[model samples]
Target: MAKELEAGFTGSPVEKPEGMRKVASDTASAIKREANAVAIGVSDHPQAAGSLVLGIGAAAFGLGYLLGRSSVSTRTRYWR
Candidate 1:
């Protein structure tokens, strides 16, 4: 495992397949634009974002509370 790891770092860099560069670039740009749009939306509507986060938090807390109070199996002695 150690040898394999060392070889991976020291070995020649791998090359991407033909046309992969263009596809990768397009996908990355699309993701970047979407992320920027989301950021702008969040910034313009801070109240909306806050409400969304609060609602999600409340739901998670309620779920956790119920799970914690659930009656699961108890430990037992098996050895004889």
Candidate 2:
């Protein structure tokens, strides 16, 4: 194993396939388009955007609260 490691391995340079490159480019463009659309929608309806953000925040807080409560209860039960 030491001799093999000392010999050192040589490898050819890897090149990205044309089809893969095209697919990656397409995916990037699609993401950009979607982001632009969302920005436009948010700009058009500021109130809706604010509500959406608040709703997401509330949901995240509720999830965290539930998880924390469950973990605390589990710990107490184990200690008992």
lDDT of 2 by residue, 1-80 (tens): 34546455587448654798779978999999999999999999999999999999999999999999887744434454
Q: Total clashes, candidate 2?
A: 0
- Those runs of model 1 whose alpha carbons end farther than 4 Å from true positions after fitting are 1-18, 63-71, 74-80
Candidate 1 matches the true fold with a TM-score of 0.52
TM-scores for all predictions = 0.52, 0.68
lDDT of 1 by residue, 1-80 (tens): 34534434665448753597769978999999999999999999999999999999999999998898785657776998
Model 1 score (lDDT): 0.85
Off by over 4 Å in 2: 1-17, 74-80
Candidate 2, RMSD to the unseen true structure: 12.0
- C-alpha RMSD of each candidate structure in angstroms: 11.7, 12.0
- Top-TM-score candidate index: 2
